[model samples]
Target: MKIFLAQQNYHIGNFESNTEKICCAIDLAKKDGADLIVFSELSVCGYPPRDFLEFNDFINKCNEAIDIIRKHADTIGVIVGAPDRNTVKEGKDLFNAAYFLYNKEIKGIAHKTCLPTYDVFDEYRYFEPAYHWNVIEFKGKKLAITICEDIWNLGDNPLYRICPMDKLMEQQPDLMINISASPFDYTHEQDRKAIIKANVVKYKLPMFYCNGVGSQTEIVFDGASLVFDKNANLCGQLPMFQSKLEGFVLNDDGSIDGPIITQAKDVPDTDLNPIGLDEHLNIADIHDALVMGIKDYFGKMGFSKAILGSSGGIDSAVTLALACTALGSENVRAILMPSQYSTGHSVSDAEQLSKNLNNPYDIVPIKNIYDSFLSELKPIFKDLPFSLAEENIQSRSRGNLLMAIANKFGYILLNTSNKSELATGYGTLYGDMAGGIGVLGDCYKMQVYALAAYINRDKEIIPTNIITKAPSAELRPGQKDADSLPDYAILDKILYQYIERRQGPNEIKAQGFDAALVDRVLKMVNLNEYKRNQFCPIIRVSPKAFGVGRRVPIVGKYLS
Candidate 1:
């Protein structure tokens, strides 16, 4: 049996263009003399339809696409992951399913058994799980087919068993096929490969994984398809971040002939094995994912040029590095604004970093602007305390400067604030938050440091001082991030369990840490909802991002 893999890109809701891509892959697979070609999950309708799922017309259009695809049923056998209406009551109204079409017939349709509800996914809110147990007989072999999350039963919590890979194994299938739209998560591929290899070793069956590739908002799906023999050795690999079709031939004697997506990247440890990759840890993979993510996001969204504030800080430096890589150095521009409190080193660093990136930059000092505002407001405030207003004034000035540049040049402002600061209300709303899109909003403070290091893996681009120095907004004199919050190593750990895992103070404290610090951090997180809410577009990488996933009332009381 010859299996074909179509690792391709798709637009979120452009059904016509996306359908054409799928049909082209089908034709290519037939040209290669393959038995059946499998596409990434939801290839027909795109991986995440988001709010489009609510529209009845959206579902109807998806159905219409399936009908359009059925025209080629006689030409070749095709496996397509698509969304369908749920017939059963008392559950979700839609089903995430796959259809096996061949010989002018819809042979077998397998509904996804597992629906992920965490992080960027809320499948339970839109999709119902397939309750039926099925194993299709194809080419004298029984085959079990599943979707992305169907095989992702491994998690921090192991008590709950969701996937029925074990159940499918009972039917004695010679091969298992899993189609996934799993997004990139620093070290997710290693965990994924291990599970697939384990299944191959345990079941004594050949396993195939076909995943999607593309960038939607901040989520990137790298289609690194794999085929593992019964001995658990990888037999085939596909392109990681682009569209390509590959074929593998399995003879009756079990001799496999093919090429896998080459294990070509110089970054170490991409093989499917167990490894931990949290924020600031998996820099190489994160760099690649972000580069692909930024490039595709700009290309797909119809934007060409980007404008960003050059704050001489590590966050802005890292964001600029990625932006330069994504949008060409010519298309990305940096603006430097020095306020009354702005240090000379900051302005100098901004110039040096832009020089390192080889991108053009403009300077617009905010001294006149800051002095003008203070001169006018000094009398009104009288002897009142100059609280956050003074700090925020500096930020708003910079935001205004960047926004003005964006407006004048018709460039989109790329926000550079990280998740740690955004999570703690350390950012000033409409100051740094005023932007068209956020590049590293989903990444944490510690993660930004890692990305900077990764960019300098070959040679130094970000200044060493930027990496080694303590973080600060520089609105106040000699203020370090530690003056307001804990160290990032401790801070990120607490935030991971709190935001992504949704553990409260009691839950986090139970995990063994300083209860006093936990209370303080929780208070800060809860109090800062308004600032995050007012933020611009936040590109999400983690499961729980600020925009929609972590919603808290701006006027809510203290939880503790």
Candidate 2:
């Protein structure tokens, strides 16, 4: 049978758009003489329709879309994902299910067996896991279908007690197909291939995976839809971060023969399978993922313009360049808000960056604004020395001006605070951290520099001075970041140890770090939970990002 994999972008809660895209893919597959077409998980209502699944009207709309899709399943078979209503009074009121439709009729239904509940997925809250396993008989072939997390429960130390594939294997299925809405991290692409290969090895059958592609808010689905022979050799893979419909001819022996990949456009057929491990490890992949995240966030939210406070620092410069790339250069605006402590080179560097990108900019000097705030608060701080409060006032001044411009012009303020600053409370709250969205909140300071170098790989997109200059907040004179915080080289390592690896101070100190410094850094990260709690939603590129993925208690004891 010739199977077509539809790796398409889906907008949550937009039934019309999602159905239209699905039907278009179906028509293309039928025209290509495809016997069957497969779509990714939750393609009807979009993945992680989070809380939108609660409304009965939402499920009704899904039913309506499924009905429309059923009508189009004439002559060609369709395997699509959608939420089905659970008729029983017990358990959750829904089942995350896949419908097999052929000859304009619903052939069979395969409910998802495993419901992932941790870290960004709360499927168990809405879905009831399947109690029975059965392979669907279609076109003289036994098909074992699974959803995103079903085949994940494998290997020596598996997540679940029972493997879904093990049960399906008992039915002696011909070929396996899994639909997924897997999100992208820099390290996930390779890990994903490894996991799929492991499944192919365990089942000893050919596998086809159709993954959704697009940025769904913070989650980015890199749609490199893949196919593997019975021996786990990768035979076909769709492009990453794109929408494409590709066909593959499956042999009767549960292997693919002469797979062909075709895109939505008029591109000729190609036999290239672009699933190399080297591609995911490249830093450029991180850059592309962040750009796609920013583009889709604005596109999905219906925002056209972006405004940010560019301090001529690497963080803001990178943010502006990325925003310009995502939302056109004409749509990105920069505000250089220099305070009393601002350096001459800082303003010039920022201007050079804006000029290079051809992005519009306005100079908003906040030295006077800082003076006004200081004058107003002089009585309360008459005897106090110039300290953090005064330093943060300058930051707040810049933030206020940028926010005002964003609000007045209907522009979204992009936060430029990097992950290192956020980890150690180096950023000011309600100040530089004020924004509608955080662009680099998950990127470490070193990664920010790497991104700067990558952005300027072909040409000098970011000014050299900005990339080479000492990182600073310019809140006070001679205010290098290292004065208040540890060196980024040391700080990022410690932060990753504690935040990503969940290593305690004692554990990190044993790894050649100073005991005192480890304690201090961990304390800072724990104490600043309240600030992060109030921060904007970040475009996540890391495995353990702040906000939704990493949940910490604001009032919890520090150094625990």
For TM-score, the strongest prediction is 2
- TM-score for each model: 0.89, 0.95
Candidate 2 has what TM-score?
0.95
Best by lDDT: 2
All models, RMSD in angstroms? 3.8, 4.6
* Model 1 per-residue lDDT at 164: 70
lDDT of 1 by residue, 1-560 (tens): 88888888898888998889888888877887878888889989897887788899998888788777777656677888888788778588888989888876778889887787766777878888888868888778677898887776644554235557777877877788898898876656676677776566567777788999988876788888888765566778776777778888765544466553333222222243222226555567677777888888888889899989897899999999999998999899999887767778888988999998899999998888877888899999777876778888888988888888888888988989898898888888888887777788888887888788789989989988778777888877877889989998999888888877777789889888799999988888888888888887676565567885566788888663
Worst 10 residues of 1 by lDDT: 266-275
In candidate 2, residue 52 scores what lDDT?
A: 97
lDDT digits (tens) for residues 316-390 of candidate 2: 999999999999999999999888799999999999999999999999898788899989999999989899999
For model 1, the superposed segments whose C-alpha errors exceed 4 Å read 72-75, 87-92, 153-171, 252-255, 258-280, 500-515, 543-545, 549-559
